[model samples]
Target: MAAVGIAVVLGLAALLPTAALPCGALQPDNTTASKLLGTWLYVAGAAQFPQHLLELLLIANGHLQVEPGAGEQELPVPQRVAVGDQCLTNNSTYFEIAVGNTTLVKHAKTHQTVGTLMNLSSEDVLLIQYQLQRERTYLGLYLYARNLNVSTERREELERYAKCLGLSEEIVYAPWKTELCQVRDIEKGNSPCREPAAVVTASPPPGTHRPGSAGN
Candidate 1:
């Protein structure tokens, strides 16, 4: 019985992290988006994995979600956020994501499905943008930023959030930056034959996995 008890404790220990992790930001539009939400990534100029960033695509109605690359999905994961701005139901009240020195505000009474604004484009496409502040962020890690256009009245709020976090719209010419580069194939130790995505950031949440690793 004692042995069985120990095993059960261990099991819970392993699961506790995941269980305790907030499904997402407990509050709406406070922290990040829902883990169950869709996310777009920017590819590096070469072919690196860690150099990927958020793209300008938007996930609707919570159909898609963000999960670790490999099944290696570990415990103690960051709580997925559920809210955006104040009115958006999906927005979380967790970490206050700031862009450009402004904190996006939630509407007094409204819920806009469109997420953070990434940029202004005619493509009619919505994507989330990732960003980092050189002054605030560490040399290795970067704070994830959202860059969705949000075509509704919520556009201003979304942009405010972007500015608060020091994140800006994905510029056509500018690309994401990171410490890693797509030098070798990362897998076979060879060079990449073709170019990867134009934007450079990290994959599977930067620092989560390395390029070529089973996670990547």
Candidate 2:
């Protein structure tokens, strides 16, 4: 039972922006500015029936990183790319959660609502603290900073939750790509290395030779 805070301390953002955002968006809305930096925590792993495994991914600086799961024991925390107050518009996932600066770190940034905050579709990232007309009805969305250990706890909880929610492991796109894994998968294996599409010539001993091995 290593304290999860160890992960937080390691993930701390050493580079805190002296002044976040461009000179342009400055005014009174710099609140969300502090929310920008730091490596966001994401699902370390997930639990799906019949699959018997799960993982969580973190995305930052154009890099998608992943944390593996602890087998069927428990899923780790849920963490991901949508950890700003930018009101990310449009995206999809099996489910979403809302958490903030953990006992580990703090959120010092803030942002403003640039457009309609609601009606977020698959492409919408609900990461903004919205200003709404209460009577009129509105849901303020805030991009959350979740625990890195969420996947494990989530898996443990969901085992019983799925039954309560009337949910099944038969979720479509269950094994979605974590940002890191996606990058890794594309990087592995040469697609056509087993056989080259085109071959020119090779140095050989007179006539007996290998294709490119000098004996071609």
Question: Which predicted model would earn the best lDDT?
Answer: 1
Local error of candidate 2 at 159, Å?
Answer: 2.2
**Which prediction has the highest TM-score against the true structure?**
1
Mind giving the per-residue lDDT tens digits that candidate 1 earns over 1-216?
A: 000000011111111122222112122232233332333222211111222222111111111123332222211122111111110111111122333322221211221111122333322222332222222221111122224333444344334433444444332211333222222222233322222222112222211111222211
lDDT (Cα, tens digit) per residue for candidate 2, span 12-76: 22322323211121121222223332323222221222221211111121111112223311112
True-structure RMSD for candidate 1: 17.9
Q: State the local distance difference test value for candidate 2.
A: 0.21
Q: Lowest-scoring 10 consecutive residues by lDDT in candidate 2?
A: 200-209
